[model samples]
Target chain A: MSLTKHPSVGEFLAGCEEHVNPYRPARLALCPMAADAEISDVSTSDTAREGDFVILWGSYTQIFGIVLKHGEIANNRFGNFHHDEIIGRHFGSRVRSRRGGLWLALLRPSPEFITQSLTHRTQIVYHADISLLRALLDARPGHIICEAGTGSGSVSASLSRALRPNGKLYTFEFHEERQKQAMADFSTYGVLDVVVSQHRDVCNHGFGEELKGQVHGVFLDLPAPWAAVPHVTKCLVFGGKVVAFSPCVEQVDKTATELRRSGYFDVRMLETLATNWGVKRQDATKKKRRTEGTTGTTAAQEAEEEEPKDVPKTSGTGEQWLSYQMPMRSHTGYLLVATRAPDGD
Target chain B: MKAKPTLGSHVVLRDLEGAQKVFLLSSGANRQELRMGKYSAIPLETLLSCPYGAILRREADGGWQRVRHSIEVAEETVEVQENNQHLAQDNSAQSLSPSEVRDLKQKCSGSEVVEALASNSATFASKTKFAQEKYLKKKAQKHVQQVTLLRPSVMELCETYYKQSRNKVCGLRYDYLSSLLCQADVRSGARFLVLDCAAGLVAGAMAQQLAGLGEIYRLFRGSYPEKGLLELDLSESEKSCVRAIHLEALESSDPWSSEWLRLPEAPGDAEGEAIAPGRAEARLTRITKRHNDFKSLEAKAVDGLIVVAEDADLCAEVLELGLPRLSFGGRVCVFGHHLQPLAALQGAWRAGNFVDVRLTQLFTREFQALPLRTHPFMVADANLCEGFILCGSKVGEAEPQEAAGEDSPTKKQRRS
Candidate 1:
């Protein structure tokens, strides 16, 4: 069966109704370029048109770049691909290189894909931690969330998608260069409407006075998350959540103690490890022949002996697919989750 | 920001021993009672005045009281014996009899009862400081008649269900569910087709994350299973976004035909009793709505497809029927308890023009991050296999002849 036809970028954008938020400016005003060029939903778009960022995925490599500017070539080990060849193609298309006859899948940009391909400014959060963080923080539409020390903006991108359409993410980064790079990446990724990047140290200056008691959740990825515990207590609403990502158990101990001291209840710490499995199909004939050879019997003899009942009969196609866990990251960091106490307690 | 628990809504009550149960706070005539441990049932109405995270304790008079102070044990350097060598495991260590303890519980508060039990213990004073604290904490968990009221969210609901009744939710772990949501790129303002058989846990979670922004078509085989969805604290608008469609209706060639739209005859009409006009009208409206929801879903491609079935073959069948309805670049994720069934779908996905196929199993460990006690929680079956997730991205069609020949080279390269 042929693949289902998808709505074009223009049609999809036309179908979207603007949702106004009183806490922030109008959606178009946040990104002026979007007003003129119309920022496509990179996370859901099917076609990779001009000015859209896409992922060129090879067998063992992935290159992320913008499809704008004519004649811009994406050079990789696979081959060189012109931006002109990428535009007007549906995402997940296998396009052949101009000279090398090599092919790569052109994929639509998504937060998960971006996390795997983005340039690292600091230690980035992988999919495992990012997924758990969304659940722990209860990040959803119409909620205001605060994230500190936007190291590489990978987690910010993922969180921005979770808080899209009406929600906002106030992300603070201490380093100037990293903040600028993250802002540029956010703009490229078409999530500037949901993310507001600041170049200040939240651990020192706090998340501003206006945000006090307004945020629904706070996430700290700082070296000293306990230093910002007091600020989180002030900025979070009653019954709000705060999560701290620390690599060391000592950090978690200090952070948990500080959270308890600040009247936060139900403090929990967890680490998630994702095990990837490799699936391979085992041929039935090869296994049978190998077993026959080991038994010092010819194939014909083994076939005749099958009726004697000691030989095991392989079921189904005998070409069974098996999965085994591959080597994975043993440790990432500890996620400390706690809820703010109710008002007056 | 301070959203209090409303009447007729569900809230999770976590006891001191970390056991959680969801309770519906009904009002006036429909008020219910919550039974905790061996104590008497407490009226659910008493919890109406408490805030979301307020801790409630049972008083000596058998009334619930909100605890204003923190419940953490203060850390102080107490004069302690060198070790727990003086402590004995003999039954004589506790001087209080079972009948006497039961009597003390009727007259004293939970803390007072704990204090009396500790004082009657012969070896409690001779134990080290750490041992003494652990002993008191263990005793408190048993004697305390307290629970913290938590607002119901997807996280709390999933954890509560996984802990209390794993089979009810199809052994779906919260972390795996979270990974599924992320991998599928579930977000606001997107349309998703969900086929959830896990007591509506998956459907309810997507609705919670959508938060009144997107549309969810919950497909079911027979009667709808909405226990988990009803337990969530969703607004009227949010609940309205989730529409249930019968699987039979999807398979019908003409959903709007009269044959499909004809209402079922009312049962027990032996006396030719006339059906109520309002009830008939309601049934007609429901039938029309079901057909109309399917028609609208057929009108456009959905952004994502999520299937959590009891078996892998059913998951494969659903994916086959759902792949055509999924938009280009849309994600497809299937949940199963075993790997063989999930692995068997790899060929089907490859043939169906899906890319980036991955089979992932998550292993999570919870650590008790306390001073000098930082280690993974030591418990039997703490790391049970939650389940497996097989996910891929649907893409545009490839030339049939070239597609068959194009896969081998990449497979060989990846192998090398």
Candidate 2:
């Protein structure tokens, strides 16, 4: 039942937007450590090149930039490094500025990194809200999804990944320029083929008839989602899901009231708080050494020597891990989810 | 997943009291109608192909009309509620007596009865729009014959059964279950060692998510409860994938024992497998399945380890005894009622091996998301016992490094 097809580069360019890459590499490679952290840098024809996005890291600070062979330089507080130096290099390989001893680590992109670094054309949805949103929608790898008001495609990007290769996201945005920019961002993010951006207002005219009776999930983020309730039902498949995100309680009340009238049931609303955590390895070397018949000076000096200090050893006092809530966004819009009737009464 | 309410499909019928009853859709049970309650019944043909969530209305005649798909909501807005100078304090607002209203209800549907009562109300026109809307909505909820058909899910099943008897399921929260599934990272094409004690709610959820690609080793302390999973609605194949293991057998060095892998006996008219040869062969079959599961489990480790046992000591036992059952980088999450058990379990894993041993308590607040009236739903369930979860992962375990100069304590007596 799963149409799990990972779109190839050619098919990816067929019907969706494609971003410009200075060098077109075959695949994406990620480096976990420094540009050169003694890890073997195996050269491959699939390494990153022009057009592919690469992250530059130095002194714990990282920046994402598109690769270019025009000798374009990426400048940050660390210094400036030419794009040519990064082109065709292994993702984990290090690069240096022409003059200063400034060093930068080149790496590939990931979901966690993209959520933080994506350039926003509008306010983007947080990753936590997106996860809970997908859960409410019963999102699987090959679900046919529809998204309205594609703000910055932050949620859309996550949806694109969730849809996988064979699935599709029919995302609509009323703003033409923002729609175009989101389309470009999807391509640069390597998931353009999985999403189809339409420059149209869904509430007034509806998501086209072709998608009617086939969509597995629908998500609305517009000011007037209630107006699109009829249209959402038209496009949603039987037993499918519809999620509407709104900040105000009135909007949820109206939307829920409308859904209550139709064949939608199991209506539930939730406000997802995405709590980030900071993990630090506790000092886990050893406990205090005990000895009898030792004098005060002897015990004091022995205790000083008994204190274990090893940096590379594993962590935790007796365990190896610790975590606390990180200072991050905790509140997002409330999500209202309902299911289409499995059978028409 | 086009879950049409065809013949013999499982469907849940919801009552006005927010209770749900599930049964098979059999038209033959009632020749002319689908018998719901003693008096309230709809024609069989009318419900034959009705959507699970559609609202069917009986006309003045013995016919029905459907308000299908989305509910036709009139775009009505209500301003703030004004002073109630024109309204009565209670039922005094209506002139009709209780017995008279009941008789009218027997003849007409709830909505029509509401309309009749509204027109007859002494102060119907005096109330503001907001007050009128709220009053009408509450009345409809109380009297409406409107029945919403719901597709059965883990949450609905638990909520329905929880209301009937919370003690049956041990107060497993819906939000907590969802969070556990996500944090445990359950997926298809993998094996999981789950210790579920939530009256099959957690097990049913994981089984549905696996979608027949993976295996669930459902460990229980005593004998497994077969009826607990009656409402799970898992397919035969999915059920077969879930191996019921007695917690005592998990301590055995051998996983091929009958307590660990209890494969059903082969078809036979006689007792004891009909023949010793057939019994021997079934044992072989059982052995192969165990080998397959354990080979991959020991190779890549299990995808995740989940425990929802109420016994607080079970977390420590599973971690100490079942750590090898999990693969590297896999999550081990234990769910319980209090933080005391988790505190002890956290201390048990203090060998610097497990990572991110977090003791978490989730507050699943239900808010009435109504503008100008948005507030948390005040209910008795909100005061239910709060549960705790301890989530950690199996990674690199390092021996505690000792001080460089601190030698092992030594004392000796010198000979004269």
Candidate 3:
């Protein structure tokens, strides 16, 4: 029987073999060309309409488009396809475009999930800041981490991805609403198992009740962080790492004072603000040919009468295109890194 | 074009009596007391929000000390003159220090000339040194030998000496120390007794070289580990050979070990006291009597302050204190076997902007060496004028904020 006879039947066959032997499919794979044949024909259109099968690529995979009926081919910019097209595909597979030339694939997110996720509340670190923080903190998998003010759970998500299965994140959020949002997001991402979001203020209670001496890393995004110094000590182990994000120098001043009082060795604070500029050519004299009598009269009708004169150099393919260099999402609070006293250990 | 106030821009305060103005404070006006130089309780918040750069100086010392808007002084007694015309003439104009200008442009671009004058070469040099001295003295007094009622570690205490000397070269050794004292992860109220192992002493000639760095901490250490040690090495070459050699020798040696080299016992004291400890205190008296006794002591840092006997087996009871009194940042800096006992203290404690300051020393021309020890301190001095050092940590944490100055997004956009 031809594999093309039915759609989900292929997935059922594949899943059944995997359950029985797990290793037999790789040995018995027959035609590699057949798998690519179906995908090669799949294509998409530019404009999205309701009840169409559209592909959204980031983080996870789902056969997304408006769902109409059980078996009807959903109309989409891409050619009509049924749910059967996706039944056998894995979450991170790619399907070919209708054009037969272009290809679209699913994205398999790195365990560091901080870079792509929606924040529920409190400002999450921008992608730029997250990249920098990852480098600064030397973030690695399986490392124990503690975070304060777990806004939207973006950072926690990223950190959790970097953690080994045994690794866990102890996060605190003062606001109950933010905590719920973060909790919900964690659950949705299937990372709730690794993250424990608590609703308590570090400034009031300290890290004692939750993290007492267990944390390997600590990150705080708080206002008036100096007040929490007494509490941080209770939770942080010797040679532990700590980073604080503050906007103002006044807070840095007070916080630094507290760190010295606490005895964290190798403390250093600095700010990173980078600017990107467009490097487009600046030919001031490069102007478009002025079209006289092109304003109010018969521009469209005139073009029709002119028999659709196709300019060899169209606007889309012109050299006078807009080249822009935009700053990545701007303004993240500054970062301060300090270590727990190294000598104590 | 209107000028904005930039972060770290200096401002001069002048009293007006028929426009015969004399500068009152050469330092930048406090952000909170933008115009309260004249009043006892001027609200600086109000003053910072004022539109005009030139305002009546308040005379009182209490309250905010600055007002954003100046009350109209008696017409005969006060006249406000602004140099906005000069600033407007130089809008986006390239100058000697464009980055510095950009910093001043955020808050009061029109008053930049005024800011420059307040932070002029002569003023910053002197003020930075004064500020460094004050910061170090305060930190030393607070964390050094003074009764903290609690102690953190010997390195925490010894760091003060290194920081003080380093700050003399760098601008705010003690200030950095104070800032590290306040980091977020550090446990509050923890005391420490610092035992700095860096071996070097500040000489008068070196102090002169320190006067050139923008701040005291800058003098001793650069922004990075290697850079700071290099700066110290180069500067010490020209300043004091005696202290420099000792420092070099320690830098090349194993810093945490007690096996480098040893000094001979000092002769008997005038009081006829024995030199053995239970007797080391009386011995120290005699040792301090001869100038050369401490002279051979060679490069000693706060991290190196613990005097170990030649016999590694001899256990000297140093740094005996409770965690509350000795804890700084909730942990103490211990060296050699000391770190072993404090294993339980290992973990994350809030600390901010920590730089490991490494020092190199040359005890003998043929035997240049380097020892290692960590001074868990912070930088506090903001004046980027001349090198200065402020303080070191004993039982305190310091937090450093981002060094890029401005707070407002629009102001940053304008500056760019």
Question: What TM-score is obtained for chain B in each of the predicted models?
Answer: 0.90, 0.77, 0.18
Q: On a 0 to 1 TM-score scale, where does candidate 1 land against the true structure?
A: 0.88
Q: CA shift at A278, candidate 2, in angstroms?
A: 9.5
Clashes of each: 0, 18, 216
True interface contacts retained by model 3: 0.00
**Per-residue alpha-carbon lDDT of candidate 2 for residues B184-287, written as tens digits (9 for 90 to 100):** 75643346888777777777777665544456777777656543465656666446556665566567667556455555455563554556876667676876
lDDT of each: 0.75, 0.60, 0.35
Assign candidate 1 its CAPRI class: acceptable
Q: Each model's TM-score? A: 0.88, 0.66, 0.34
By DockQ, the best candidate is 1
Name the 10 consecutive residues with the lowest summed lDDT in model 3 chain A.
Answer: A17-26
What order do you get sorting by TM-score, best first? Answer: 1, 2, 3
lDDT of 1 by residue, A264-284 (tens): 988899988788776666554
| Candidate of highest lDDT | 1
Interface RMSD of each: 6.8, 16.8, 30.3
DockQ of 2: 0.08
Q: In model 1, what is chain B's TM-score?
A: 0.90
Candidate 1 vs candidate 2: the lDDT winner is 1
